[model samples]
Target: MRPQQGMIPWGPNTTAGGRAGTQGGEGAVELVMVNPTEQAAIPRGGNSLQSQPDGKGHFGGVHGGRFVAETLMPLILELEAAYAKAKADPAFQAELAYYLKDYVGRPSPLWFARRMTEKLGGAKIYLKREELNHTGSHKLNNVMGQILLARRMGRTRIVAETGAGQHGVATATVCALFGLKCVIYMGATDVERQKPNVFRMRLLGAEVVPVTSGAGTLKDAMNDAMRDWVANVADTYMLIGTVAGPHPYPAMVRDFQSVIGEETKAQMQAAEGRLPDVVVAAIGGGSNAMGIFYPFLDDSSVRLIGVEAAGHGLDSGKTAASIERGRPGVLHGNRTYLLQNADGQIEEAHSISAGLDYPGVGPEHSWLHDIGRAEYVGITDGEALEAFTFCTEMEGIIPALESAHAIAHTVKIAPTLPKDALIAVSLSGRGDKDIFTVAEHLGVTL
Candidate 1:
């Protein structure tokens, strides 16, 4: 069968060594999925999606790269080298593992949502309980890894950007644990809406700086953090919260967050004796989605779905569904799908969930979308809110608004699939930080 536009033409039974034909004669490489025990057996340069970007950071031949100011090149290069060294060192791995298991509470449970599954009445639903992490989100996974790397590099100060404040909170928590100075740049709007998280950051000894530029959201916060990094390259390490940045960051953060996927794979096998039928996650900068999607990339039988926040609707000119309604463009240092206009001006994205309010998605996600390795869909704010309430009532779980987007999509598709279909959704964070925002939307004053 011919491949559809923007999708790779690989059949379900395609093996690891299979080559898929793409449009315009661009050859596509198929990824090989391996069992957890055999992961080390795969060759370093094999045809796996995990070993992507080809040393230049460009995924699928085009989606990622270091498009940063020349001033930051030295620092970026230094970070890349340090991270590479740390990755290869067993000592660094052991340190990071200790912190993750003891402090951050990793290997979060894979919960079977019996109530939600019965309510949906089709697919069996399993929620990857990232919310159970110490910082109340999967943000801790990446933050812990980066903070340890920063310590290894002898950086005494750490800077970061946040939208929903989960990343900010997680970064601050780690910095506090290590006694490093922390500075979090948050959009003014986010700072206002996510006051609880802002307070949490402050309590954790992080100085929160509010950026008032560009709709006062994640993109603006990232811009300010990058500026701060450029000015203080001597002692400051920029702890990026997501997977949308330059070369080493996109790959580095993915490596750190891949633990989520790895755990899910093993846990799913233990629970069901096989891989899950579908893996679902919400996409903001696409970290959580990438974290959960990376391990299963080569498993042709397992479907990967990423749900983007559609603030109003896909066509309403105000949505964060970058992969769905956007074109490829450069933003936040990487070439990816962005919500831009006719003149290529970056458009402000809209979403009730601050985390998913960015105008661009991760470059890896763009590559995956182009190659049909995964599917992305948009969930409107209303739908997410509904799911938020439904999940709370049905599963007794309060999912962060960001994760509610994934749950909303699951609510839609679960009923359509067969009863035995297994679906795993990344509950990336708790709803505690989103209570104020949700209250206001529901016309309740708290």
Candidate 2:
């Protein structure tokens, strides 16, 4: 039976293959993924960069391409063409830019965490307060971009998957703005934990689908949404919440989200007259991290660090440290590192933070890790809780549970880095959505 309206629950004993099985066992399904090397050939005459598959060969290099099942190829091709045209049109870009800056509140503050920095006794910490955005998370950035693209493509409906429901809220909000029909699929567990956001999505006029498959997390919701897209591809555009997934999405999300770093660079330069010594962000599907890191990819002198939730501990079976425990494999339309068993069956990634719990990182992140351009690290649930509380106390800021992973690193590394060095961390979202969960963790009530 389909889950009831509002929120649902998922557990370790649950499975996501209910619908996916009828279509095909998600079993070892492989799709050709593009690598960066192949991207060079795409711009041959510069007829536009859409022709090349992202780095591996699926669509656009590094990011951009198709990853749907064969049944959805016609719709995928139509979307590909629409996106391609919209990308090249100046009017579309300008219109979207206006909404980004005005409607969704782009160029969010680059705040200096003076109190927190002083207490840590190390590097100065600056925060990209994406939490200030309209929907209270960096997810708004991508949703706005995708929904606009959908409008330009003449698409009338949108679909998405959410874990903590922040992305679902964002997508629903944009759909309301554009007067498009919206549907969101969410894990039952996530729905129960993030009730407020679920209500918010409903208030915005979206149909919320409670996903009952898998452990009822982000992946399960994604599977359900993908099935919907396959069935309704002609009129629906799947607004993926993160920078993971197949080709075009990873690249497309990064492009829309790059505004974070773009604003950060200008703000830091004006405030400090120089670039930061380091950039830090928590990684799930890697959209936030990639948004901040992609622009800095060419900056060899700056250090880039990505934090993943360590849940209980990496030493235990319960952890979401994909970089530490995962191996290279393919899942969800891309070839990248994934947390999987010996037979390549994806494993459940553990994290106390619902938003950070995922079994895979973005393909570009996999490449970044392979080339050593970025350092990936993990922080335990205990450490994250400490940092979460510390930030609220010292800085008077309530950070998202996921962002606490990066904050936890500051707790450990701040004392070690030079006091004069500058560090910028992506505070990806606000804490209102997490208040209930954190309250329960702290033995309190709202």
Specify the highest-lDDT model's number. Answer: 1
In order of appearance, the predictions have TM-scores of 0.92, 0.86
- Write down the lDDT of every candidate, Cα atoms only: 0.85, 0.76
Q: Candidate 1 regions off by >4 Å?
A: 1-41
Which candidate leads the pack in TM-score? 1
Worst 10 residues of 1 by lDDT: 17-26
Cα lDDT of model 1 by residue, 1-446, tens digit: 11134443222321222111111111212212212223333343355665576566777667778999998988888988898777766677778778888898776888999999998899999999999999899999899889989998999999999998999999999998989999999999999988889999999999999999888989999999999999999999999989889978988888788888877877777777778999999999999999888878877899999999989999999899999999998887889999999899999999999999999999889888988889999999999999999999998999999999999999999999999999999999999888888999999999
Give one clash count per candidate, in the order shown. Answer: 0, 26
Off by over 4 Å in 2: 1-67
Candidate 2 residue-wise lDDT, 140-195, digit = tens: 88888799888877789899998888899999999888789999999998888888
Candidate 1 Cα deviation (angstroms), residue 224:
0.7
